[model samples]
Target: MPDAKPRLIVIDTDPGIDDAIGILLALASPAFSIAGMTTVAGNIGIETTTRNGGRLLAFAGREDIPVVQGGAAPLSRPGPEPLNLHGENGIGGVALPEPVRPPESLPAAAWLAEFLLDQPAGAVDIFALGPLTNIARLFIDNPDAARRIGRIIAMGGVVHEVGNVGPRSEFNLWADPEAAAVVVSSGLPLVLVPLDVTRRVRASREFAQALRVAGKPLASMVADLVESYFETKTHQESRPLHDPCVMLFALAPELFRLEDLHLVVNTGSTEEAGALTVDGNGTPVQVAIGVDGPAVLDLLARTLTAA
Candidate 1:
C-alpha cells in the first residue's frame, strides 16, 4: 500500500492557463487535501482571477473548496496590466459557464493566515503560483501563522536565464517584486522553482497530442491552449508547464535537484526590474536546478486523467 498523504494545504494562485493545470493536479493528487484556494492579481485582476479559480473548482466538481480574492496590486509596484498569454479572461480563452459558487467571505490574505494558524504546525504546505503579494501580507499580519507552514513551494524567478518580462525578471516576480522579497526573506523553508529549470522543461507536441487523445474536455482545452501559446510566441514550439513544477516539487521532491542560495528581488532600474538576484551567501533557500522532465509530463498526464 502507498504511504498516508498529507492532509492540509492552501494554494495561492492567479488562474493562468498553467495555473489551472496546477490546481487540477493538486485536486487530483491523493497526496494533498486542499484546505482552500486563494486568488491574487498576477494573470489578471483580482476579481477575474478569483472567479476563474472558482470556475476551475466548479468544473472539477470540487465546489467544497472555498475560493477567496486577495491583493489587487503588488506591495510596491503599480499593478501590471494582464498578459495575453492566458487570454484576456485567463484560463486559456476557454470560458466555462459562470461559476455558481460565491467566493468565501474573507479576503485571500486573511483566509490564508487564519487557515494556516488553524492547522497543526508543519502540517500545511503553501503552493504559490502567482505574485507573492497575498502571501507577504499574510506574513505581515500574522507572522506566527506564516511560520507554522511546513514549507512554501513557489513558481517564480529566473535565476539562470533571461527574464521573460524584462532583461532580468520573470512575469510573476516582476508583477510584485516587493512581495517576492518579503516572502523570500520571511525565514520559512522555501523551495523555489524558477524559470531556470522550468524553461528547460517543455510540453512537447507529442505530449499535447496525447492529452488531446484523452478525449476529456479539460485536457483537450489545456492541449489547445498549449498549442496556441506556443505558436504565438517566437521560437517557442512548446509551452512550459511552469506552475505545475512547483506542485511537483512538493508532491515528488525526489524528481528534482535542489540547491540552497540567497535570492534577492530587484525592484528598481527599468532595465532589470523584478529580477531575482541570487547571492550564494547569507540565509539560503532551496532552488530547483533540474528535473526529470519526461517523467513529470507523464505524471501530470496520468494525474489529470486519474479517476
Candidate 2:
C-alpha cells in the first residue's frame, strides 16, 4: 500500500532561538507537511522574525514553503520586551545571509484563512510558537476559517512556575492577554505547553555537543546558539529550551502526560492583566504536566541530524 499522507501543519512563530530550533525540527521531519510559516512579533520585532523565517527555510532547503508576515504587535497593550531579551536581531545575533525569496504577499491571517478553506475542516494542526496575535486575528477576521483548525498546540502560560515577564505572566500570553483570552474561549481543541513543563527540556552540554558533531552548517549554527544561551546564566549549566518543546510534544505525544484544567486569563488594565490563573469556572484546556526528557532530547538530536 502507498504510505499515508503526511499531516498538514501551520507553524506560527517568532523565530526566537528556541523557535528557530523548533522550525528546524519541523523542516527535518517527514511525518508532517508544513503548509506555511506565519511570522509574529514576540521575541523581537515583526520584521526580524519574518526575515528569520526566510533564512531558516534557506538553511533547510524548504524555501518552497511560504513564509507569510503576520501581526506587528499584540491585539492590545503593546509593550517592549525585556531589554536585549533576544539580542539585536533576534536569534541571538546569529549571522545568516538574506533570503533571495520574499515572503508571501498576503497578510498572515488572510493567507491562513484562504489556505484553511481549501483544506478539509479539521485537517490542519497549528503549532503556535509565539504569541496568539495572529491566531486571534484569524478568529476576528475569519471566524469560519478559525473553526476549521484541528488543534492549536501553543507554547505559553505558566501554571506553578514564576512568570518570565512579571509576577504572574509568561511572555507569550503576557505580550497579549487579549489574544490568549480569545483563543482559549474559542472552544477549539487547544493544548497548552506551559512553562511548568518547558523548563524541564534544557539544552545539556551533551545535547549541544551532538549538534556540533553533526557536521552540518545548520546544526553547527544551532549548536553555537545553544552555547551562547548559557553565557548569561553563569550559574546554570543549561537553559530551558522553550518553543522546541512544543514541537517535541507534537511528534511524541505518548511521551507526555497532560491534565485537563480550567484557566482564567486576566485581560484587565492592571499590572496583572496578562496573568493566567486556574479557577473552576475558567476555560477548560489540556495543559502538559509531564514529559520524558531523555526521549525528547534523543528525538531532537536524531531528527535534526538525520540523513
Candidate 3:
C-alpha cells in the first residue's frame, strides 16, 4: 500500500548547516517521501552545495536518493563563492565520503520540471531552502510542470524582523531577488517561513547539549554545527534554526500559524534587494506568523536521534 501522507516533496537547497538539519528531519520523518533533491548556490557555491547534498544523503544512509546539481549563480547576479558560515565544507568542518551515486543526467531545473510533470496532480510540494534561481528557471521553461506542484514551502525574506544578509534582505533572496519575484508572483500556493518567525525560534545551549546526548551521529553533528555557528553570530546564546523551520512547517503544520497574504520580492531596489514585502491587501499565499519553537526543537531532536 502507498503511504497515506499528502506530500511528495522535492528539496531545492544549498546545504548550509540548517539545510542539513532540514534534510535530515524530512528524510527521517514518515510524513514525507522526498522524491528528489536539487542543489543550488546560496550559503555556498553550487559545487560545494551539491557536494554537501551528496555528503548529507550518504551520511543519512540515503545514497539511493538522487542529488542533482542546479544553477551555480542566480539569474542576473554574479556567482557567490561558498561562504564560511558552515565552515570550509558547509558541514561544520566535518568530512564525509563523496556520494557513490552520481547526479541525474539533466540539470536541476530540467529535472525538477520533469519530476513535477510525472507526479500526480498536486502531489508534489517544493521545499525551497535556498535561492529561487532554479525554481524560477524551471517555471520559465515548463509552465505546465510549475502548475502541477501542490505548493512551495520556502525559507527566505523578512517581513517583520531584520534581514540576515542586509538591513532589508535575507541571504537566500538577496542571492537572487529577481528569481524570487518571479516565483512569488507566479500565483503558486506558497508557505513562506520568513525571518519574522524564524528569528524568534532559537537553538540554545540546552538544546545543543540535548542533541549531542541523543546518541545519533547526525544529530550530534548538527548540534556541533549549530553550536559553532551560534558562536560566530551576535546571538551566541541562541541561534535561529532558519532553514529547518520550513521543513517543520511541512512535517507539522500545527506547529505554526499560517496567514494567507500577498507577498512581493524587491529586486530593483539596491537598498532592499531581497526584501519580501507583503501586500497590505490580503493575498493568497500562506505566510507563517508564529511557531512552537520548543515543540519544533523536540521534534527535531527526536527525529534526528532516532535509530
Candidate 4:
C-alpha cells in the first residue's frame, strides 16, 4: 500500500455476482476507506441484496461496516421482477455463511443523510454500484446533504455499446428511470462508468485459474462464484466486469478518458426509459469514454490475487 491518503467512500450497491466482485475489490485495495454500504433494489429485491451485503462483508471479515437497507422499489412504476441473472439468492448461488450482524435500523436515505451532513464538504465520495433510487432520494429528500457530497462514481448508462435492457437502457437506470432522471438533473458531481468503458475491461475464462492459484480465501471463493456465472454467460473468454470497473476508476481515474458532457435520461418514454442522451441542455457531468483495458485488467488481477 502506498503512503497516500485513503479515499473515504460510501458504497451504494445491489450485490449481484459483479457487485460481489466490486465490493471485494474495494475492500482489498488499500486506497479506499469504506464508510458503509447502502443497499438498493436492482438485480434482486431489497431483502436479498441487503442480506447479501452483510454476507459479503462477513465473508470479507469486515462485519464492522454497516449495511443499510434502502428502497425496496423505484420512485415510480413497479421494479422489474427480481433478476435471475445473478442466481436465486443474487450472489451466483454461492452459499456464503449467514451474516452474524443485521442491517442498520435507520433506512438508507436517513442514514446517508446523516452521514453526509456529519462529514465536511466533499469529504466522502459515493460509489453507486447499483440503481440510483437511493441516491436520487438523497438529493430529493435531503438537498443540503446532497450538496456536500464529493462525487458520485456510478456504473450505468451506455454510450457506444448496445444497451443491456432495451435498445437504449442499461439494467440499473432502466430499473428506475425516474430516479436516474432525478440524479442526472440534481447537479451533483458525477463520474459515469457506462458500458462504453466497462465492456472494454473484462475477466476472461483464465481469470478463474488465476484466482484459484492465489489460494487466498477471498480469491478462491470469488473464483468459484465466477465460474458458476460463466456457466450461463456467453463469451466465456471475456466477461465484462461492470461494477468492479467503476470501483477501479475511483482508485485510478487517470487510466480512463473522462469527458464532460451534458447528459439526459429518458423518463417519458416507455420503450426508451433510462436511455442516456447527449443534450446540450442536459446536466453537465463527466462520462468515461476511453480506458486502457489491459492496464485495468492487470491491476485487478494483481489486487485480487494479493488480496
Candidate 5:
C-alpha cells in the first residue's frame, strides 16, 4: 500500500535563523508532507536564502524536497539591505555544508503556481516566513489558482508590540509592503502570526545550553544557532524563535488564541511602509494574539533535540 498522505505544506521563506528552526521542526515532525519550498528575498537576498535553504535540507537529510528560487526584490519598493542580525550569511554565519542538490529550473512564483494549481483544492497549506513577493505574484497572475490554497499561515506584521525593523513595520512585510498589501487583500484565508505574540515566546539560554550537551549533531547545530541569535541582542537574555511558532501553530492552532480582524497593509507611503492597520470593516484575517510561550519552547527544545 502507498504511504498515507500527510498534510502538504509549501513554505515560501527567507532562511533566517528562526526559519532554519521552523524548517527543521517540520522535517522532524511526521504530520507534514513538505510539498516544496520557494525562497524569496527578505532576511537576505534570494541567491543566499536559496542556497541556505538547500543547505538546510541537506543538513536535515531531506534533500529530496524541491527548492525553488523566487523574487530577488520587492514588487514596488527598493529592497532593504540584508540585515546583519542573522549574521553575514543569514543563519548567524554558521557554515552549513554545501548542498548536493540545486534549486528547480523555474522561478519560484511559476513553480508554486504550477504545483498548487495541479493539486486538488485545499491540498496545500502555504507557510510564508519572509517577504510576500512570491505569493503576491502568484495571486496576481493566477487568482483562481491562489484561492485553491488550503490556508496561508504567515509570520509578519505587528499587532500591538513595537516593530522590529522600523518604527511602525516588521522586517518581512516592510521588505515588500506592496506585495503584502496585495496578499492581505487577496481574500485568501490568511492567519497572521505577528510580532505581538512572537516576541512573547522566548527560548532561554538554559534550554540552549541543555541542547548543546545533546549527543546529536543537529541538536548541537541548533544550540549554536540559538546562541548566535541571542548574541545579536543586547537587552534580551532569551531569543524569540519567530518562524518556528508559525509552524507549530499550523500543526496545532489550539495552542494559541486567535482573533478575527480586518487588516490592511500600508504600501503607498514610503516613510510608513508595511504599517498594518486593523479595522472592523476591512479585509478579514485571523491574528494570533496569545500563545502558551513556555509550552511552545518546551516543545521546540524537545523536537529539535530529538531530531
Candidate 6:
C-alpha cells in the first residue's frame, strides 16, 4: 500500500503539444493529484488554452478537474503575437475532439486564490508551463493565498542555449517578463526547468512508435501530436519534449542535477526583456542544469502508454 499522500497540485499551462504531454505525464503518475488547471495566454489565447485544458482532461479521463480561464495578456505590456509553432489552435495541427465541458465561470486567478487559501499551508504545488500572468495576478489579488503553495516549478528561460524568441528570451519568459519578475519577487520557492536542461532531452522515434502502437485513444492522439509537431517545427527527427521534463523532475528529482541560482528577470528594455541575470542577492530559484534524458524519456513512454 502507498504510504504517502499524493501531492496536491495545480497546473497553469497554455497547452502546447509539449504541455499536453506534461499534463498526461502528471496525471499518470502516482505522486500527484491535480487539484485543477488554470489556463493563461501564451502559446495561444486564454480561450483556446482553456479549451485545450478541458479537452486534455477529457482525454486523460479526468474531466472532474475544473479548467479555469486566466489572464489573456501580460502584466504590463503585450506579449508576442501568437506563433505558428504550436499551430493555429496550439496543438501542432492535430485536433482532439471538442471537450464535453466548458471552463469554470470563476476567473483563473480568483479560483486559484480560493483553492490555495482553502488548502493547508504548503499543501499545494504548482507547475507553471506558460507565461506567468496568472501567477502574478495571484500575488496581486491575494498575496496571502500565494503563501499556501508548497512550491512552483516553472518551465521557461534559456541559460546555456540561444533563446528561441529573442537573443535573450525563451518564449514563456518573453511572453510576460513582468509577470515573471513578480513571481520571482513574491518570495515563493521556485524551481526553473529552463532550456539549458530541456534542450538536452528529446523524444526518440522509438518512443513515437511505441505511442502509436499503444492503440489507446490518448496514445494515438499523443502520437499524432508529436509527429506533427516535430515534422513542422524541428530540424531533427526528434523534438525537445520541454514541458514533460518538469513533470519528470517533480516525480524524481534525483534524475536531475540542479543548481541554486539567485536570479532576476529583465522586465524592462525591449531588447533585454526576459533575460535572466544571475546575482548573489537576487531571488533564489533552483535551476536544472543537467538531466538524465534517457530516464525522462523512459518515464514519459511508460506514463503515456499506461494512461
Instruction: Tell me how many clashing residue pairs each candidate has.
Output: 0, 0, 1, 0, 0, 0
Decoy 3 TM-score against native? 0.93
Local error of candidate 6 at 153, Å? 0.5
Task: Please state every model's RMSD to the true fold in angstroms.
Answer: 1.9, 1.6, 2.2, 1.4, 2.1, 1.5
State, as a TM-score between 0 and 1, how close model 4 is to the true structure.
Answer: 0.97
Best by lDDT: 4
Tens-digit lDDT track of model 6 for 48-95: 888988888887778888899999999889767887888888888776
Q: Give the candidates in order of lDDT, highest first.
A: 4, 5, 2, 6, 3, 1
Task: Give the poorly placed runs of model 3, Cα more than 4 Å off.
Answer: 1-3, 230-235, 280-283
Q: Candidate 5 versus the native: TM-score?
A: 0.95
The residue-by-residue lDDT of candidate 4 on 31-87, one tens digit each, is 899999999999999999999999999988899999999989999888888888888
Query: TM-score per candidate, in order?
Result: 0.94, 0.95, 0.93, 0.97, 0.95, 0.96
For candidate 1, lDDT tens digit of each residue in 54-98? Answer: 888887788888888889888866899898878878876775666
For model 5, name the residue pairs that clash: none
User: Model 2, 1-307: lDDT tens per residue?
Assistant: 9877788999999988899888888877777899999999988888989999998888777779999999998887775563365677788777776765899999999999999999999999999999899999999999999999999999999888788877788889888889999998888899999888888888976778888899876677778778767766667788888898888998899988999999989998776767888999998999998888878888888877873
Best by TM-score: 4
In terms of TM-score, which candidate is stronger, 1 or 5? 5
Tens digit per residue, CA lDDT, model 3, 1-307 = 9867646789999988889878878887778888889999988888889988998888778988899999988888785556777887886776677887888889998998888878788999999999999989988888889999898899988877778778878888888998888888888778888898888678888888988887778788777777777656755678788999988887788989888777778886585898877776534578898888888877788877884
Q: How far is candidate 5 from the true structure (C-alpha RMSD, Å)?
A: 2.1
What are the Cα lDDT values of the candidates?
0.83, 0.87, 0.84, 0.89, 0.88, 0.86
Which of candidates 2 and 3 is the stronger one according to TM-score? 2
Q: Give residue 146's lDDT in candidate 2 (0 to 100).
A: 92
Give the poorly placed runs of model 4, Cα more than 4 Å off.
Answer: none
